[model samples]
Target: MAAPTFTDAVVKAMKTLYPPELADSAWDNTGLLLDQALLPEGTESKQSEGAVLLTNDLTAAVVDEALEKQVNIIVSYHPVIFRALKSLSNQDPMQKHLLRLIAARVAVYCPHTAVDAARGGLNDWLCDIILSETKEAERKVVQPISRPLPESLQGLGYGRTMKLQGPMPLTTILKNLSRGLGDQQHIVLKDADAELIVTGEMDHHSALRYTQLGQTVVTVFHSNSERQYLTQVLKPELEQMLSQSSRAEGRVLVSQADRDPFETIDISSLGS
Candidate 1:
């Protein structure tokens, strides 16, 4: 089928799949991995097709990868260029990245906190994964990760709680968490070998302790952690555009670009 134009694909995806309610009130901008003008009218070049790049930071290596792949658009979760830019002197790393982006004619877009805070965003995405695995477990799913109440206080730090049921292998659970969160942060899943503990956010001491107990638990940044939204919400929207475009024209070949920027983590020796 003829793919939809990139603009149509991006616009439709953002408007239909990511409703405003899904985004946080504070997040002002959300949609398009990058501006449309950067690429061919509605069509990304062949060099910049397939594999959408996802990342909070748009680093040199990341941009280089896009160039090598001939990707014209970057569907970044975090905006590489936030606020206003007075100059593009390439003085800063970000600026350097931007310079490269413009030179390569790569399109970059960020969904930011809107995607994070969305109803099916990071938090809920994590919760759903955990709950799905423990669907048949003895314990009940709580809903979200809750921080443990202070030793003496009545509530946990963030009031977040774990919703995992049954005795999941520490390794298994942590793997799921890391995968669901896109392995952005290093967390030590504590003596969670045979125990379960929930917290509002990850603490260094707690994370360290988890490692000491032969477990790994670490809380990743809100940005790096939840990336599946692209596939769950963004990609589908892109596909739909292609479907519509095919019906309208001979074929609208629309594709995405890869732009994530975190290096792979060797979880086996995460802290060492």
Candidate 2:
């Protein structure tokens, strides 16, 4: 039998922890999206084991970081190949990055919504962050899985809603949000049907609609909402799972380049 490659180990650990079945497959393209172990068109296979790099997205910069670090696999939280592609071409930046990744034989895997929907996954972690100020709260799934899974994942869902123990001031919640997400620059934490809604994003009109209905909406700016979980939760979990799976020994590192694209600027400072 062939030795388990590093890519194989990472995939196994991801699937075991965040089963693809838990993902919202209708729109999400999760699991091993790239496999260096499969070998490219004309070249012989290179070393199949190296370090793991975790990132929220697989951009060209992240790819460069992966190559510099000589990682065998990247556990990106978002899929680079999100839309249906007719072909790969350098003219498009993301496609160019894909080609580059392929050339370097750096495999890519994404657990996107699986991580969100899995019990104790990103959504749960987000809840912990949002409610960390409270002594206790009742957290319930905002959307339970439509697809069935084993009993082990009975309550897995994509988002969480919490009923605070006591009527804590919203200012305290805002302070906790800023502290928890490490979003020092933005103080605009504010969302759900269950009382408040916290998400990576919400369109302006939708946010207005919810607010009009007396529900608070908090938008952490998509990738920003997901990035910290990769560092705090996924990194440690992958490390533990990798150690258990015995892929021999390899380092699991988070990418420094990965970040949310949107930033709120203080343009008034320009007047100075």
Candidate 3:
């Protein structure tokens, strides 16, 4: 099929997360950027043939990159523009970025918190990654899982529920989760006598109760548990999109990003 129009792809991605009918009132910003007519054919002066730039943080530097690349559509996981707009002064960074995009006929779109909580957005993807098996010497083993990232949360966001599937021991699961979450010390282990449970953020009362009960309960720091969603979910999705685009165009133009910003650890460091 002809590559879906940029706007259409974006709309499809959003609908994947939030059905217009099911979304809450707060998710009003989960849609396209400015109209198609205002967008330029290719970005100029930090513009392109209307390419779309996607990222977790919509910082000034990122905006500059988008302009430099002449991107027509910017699909940021985080909303670059927030708060009520009192006015649009060129002095502010975001305003400057907005002005630059507008001047270049680029349209910036953000798919914040709404996307995170979506079914296949952040949480669901993370859950799948954790459950996936890693291969070693032809043997496959399950890997530990981590929570999604700030951008994914802002873009898609998530809610928590207690049900889980798997037969791994609770202690092993907690350790693996810690590894996945960047080894933050915030995770606490409790001993509840019967069933074990894991919570993303720490709760003292719950910890104490679990400890008293002898259940092996663990709590994850809120920030750590949710920081990798962008790397884990959005990046892969974009890669797939870019890959398909490249194949259809008969060129190796668009490609997957080499690194994820949230994983402070370098893959190169492992061999050393």
Candidate 4:
């Protein structure tokens, strides 16, 4: 498939898989934020043959990777264009990334909170990670879709909560979380009404408040909580679904340049 046709297929697949309507439009910017057709035209040599790059964030490194590989489109999990841009200049690092992609004709799409609210989406994946130790668990939405509710997505919503059939030790849960997110550090167990909360991050004060009320919030930093889903879940799905939808071979590649900016340092050893 040609690059344009391939990008169209990706946009379609993204919409079919994680509908933009499911996103929290109140704050999020979802869907195809950067369209090549709308942006300034540039030389787009067919390099990777309809390859789609997946990343948790659209950082400068991710943009460089996309351009180097000449990916047809980028399915960034978090939207790059979150706020209004008064100007597209080299003054801002983000605007520079956009400018480079525009020059290379690499399009960008973000699924954001849409993936969180969709059935079998990011939040659901998080639920699976939270319940990795449980043999079976009942899960439900913390907030259900209220507006423009489609019949197919009747029960799908933003956050998810799990109720286990049997009580599992919090230590056991943390162990599974380590295995799931590929990070063994920051596994702290306080308490929770739901017994556990596996989230990206929480405000310091809000987390304190929750803990005061006996709710444990497990934060694996922001992007760390979301990065694995691209490689483990979305990559294979995109390859299969995009191929079928386009009736042509389409590839989905997870960006190697993306990662959580935070790291856990052992100060005890550092000072020694």
Candidate 5:
């Protein structure tokens, strides 16, 4: 028996779970970004046979970790290299990371928006989380807000909207949302209407207006590429792919250090 190469694992995984052609957004940069063969000499062997690191975003720190751990492939949920780079110079931090990964012989693969809109991907997982938390009386009605790029890609969309059964108290709704998101105090409740009018900086101090139509309370939740969902939703798929592949020993690991870059603070608490 022979160990499967990185390309082999990626091909099998893509065919089974996320086909880059079928899953990628028109503007997305999915599929293989960097190949091990393209790396500098004495970096690593051409064969990709090591642990796979799964991360939402690929940073220089992550590349360092991959080099230290001898990780051959990085399955970044978000594409690290987006847009055309005029040059790979030290002036640009992203280019620096690219050069680092290239030198380390690490292969980069990104699923990006393709995974978000996949049949049983991020958006569906997020929708399930919110719907699961709602009480029976809440009678959640969930629908995808973003239309699919093509008509054939039905049920594939970015965000979804859930209409509550009845008008929920603003506080209660906030609490439910907080619990669902795993953060209570840091949740941002903004009035979308006011956002259009007010040009200045608006924090938690800004008044929140809950849009309501008759007995139903409507709220929209937008996910900013949070990696937490990837750990829960994509892990099983990756594991299954690995098990089915020749390289059953190849492990699919979610990066422990990955987190949302932005930190939220409750401005209301500052006043008290």
Candidate 6:
């Protein structure tokens, strides 16, 4: 059988997995951004046949990789073209890639916050992973901080607030979180009240904050998007989508080139 060519039908099928209407924020840009261009005169749609490439961010490197691998579609978890752009030009890196994608005729789709707030989505996945590290005796109650108002998405929400079985010191909690979340992650711990009142350079530099609330210690952990969770949880669904679309073994390729651009630098290493 011939390889399945990407079509509007396939894109529609993919959207059913995480509908754009369920996105947490109204500002989010979800769903299909670009579509496969029509073939030239005398050319066949099958000529554009290729596999799907998944990435958390559609960086220029991912675009080059897609072109090299002959990927017909890109499913980026984050919107590549966000905010109002005055114009598309080489002056901006994102614009350059947009032009490249257009020239190559590759379709781009971003699920964004839809996947984050969807049932069994990113927020839930993150909460599950973190809780998995704790013993059952240690976790008292775990629930979403705020749930979606929609009846269909009752349990789905933006973040989770978990109550420990017993009061734990702020340092101990941070240590446990570090172990679960990984050492490389840049985590900011803040007292919920202080977070609202604090401002200036000191806010950015603080790694951990402690507050006394009688016998209880509470801290909020804020992190940038962790792509690893999305890659792990979404792979199976992506594979199924590909299998159904192509009528073959699904080949969902996660980009190995993806990485967090920010890095923690130890300036102390430099001689003072």
Model 4 lDDT per residue over 223-262, tens place: 7767878878888777778778753677788999997776
Q: List all candidate RMSDs to the true structure.
A: 7.7, 5.3, 8.2, 5.3, 6.7, 6.3
Displacement of residue 64 (Cα, Å) in model 5 is 1.4
TM-score-wise, the better of 1 and 4 is 4
TM-score of 1: 0.57
lDDT of 5 by residue, 1-272 (tens): 64557556865685567666655455677778777655454654743465788887887777777777777788887777778877888778878877887776777888776676567766666555545555765544434353453342333234434445444345555565455456534443443321111111222322222222122222323333246556667777888877877777877777866656656566888895
Better structure of 3 and 6 per TM-score = 6
How far off is residue 215 in model 6, in Å? 13
TM-score of 2: 0.85
Candidate numbers, best TM-score first, in rank order: 2, 4, 6, 5, 3, 1
Q: How many residue pairs clash (N, CA or C atoms closer than 3 angstroms) in each of the candidate models, in the order given?
A: 38, 9, 35, 1, 0, 0
Task: List model 6 lDDT by residue over 1-272, tens digit each.
Answer: 53345545446656777777877555666788777775677865442354678887778889888888777788887778768888889788988888888777788888877776666676666566556656676665554453543342233234444545454455544554455455434444345432121110122323233233212222223223346555666777766665666444435678877765656687998777
Q: Mind giving the per-residue lDDT tens digits that candidate 3 earns over 100-199? A: 7666666655666555456675555444434434234312333323343233233233443333443545555555665665655445666554665454
Task: Mark the regions of model 3 whose C-alpha exceeds 4 Å error after superposition.
Answer: 1-8, 16-23, 33-47, 129-157, 162-171, 178-227, 238-272
**Would you estimate the TM-scores of all the predictions?**
0.57, 0.85, 0.57, 0.84, 0.70, 0.71
- The CA lDDT of each predicted structure is 0.52, 0.75, 0.52, 0.75, 0.60, 0.60
C-alpha displacement of 243 in model 6, angstroms? 2.7
lDDT of 6 at 181: 50
Candidate 5 residue spans exceeding 4 A from truth: 1-4, 22-24, 38-48, 135-157, 161-177, 191-225, 265-272
Off by more than 4 A, model 4: 1-4, 37-46, 136-157, 192-194
Expressed as tens digits, the lDDT of each residue in 50-75 for candidate 2 is 59999998877898899888898889
Indicate the worst ten consecutive residues by lDDT in candidate 1: 246-255
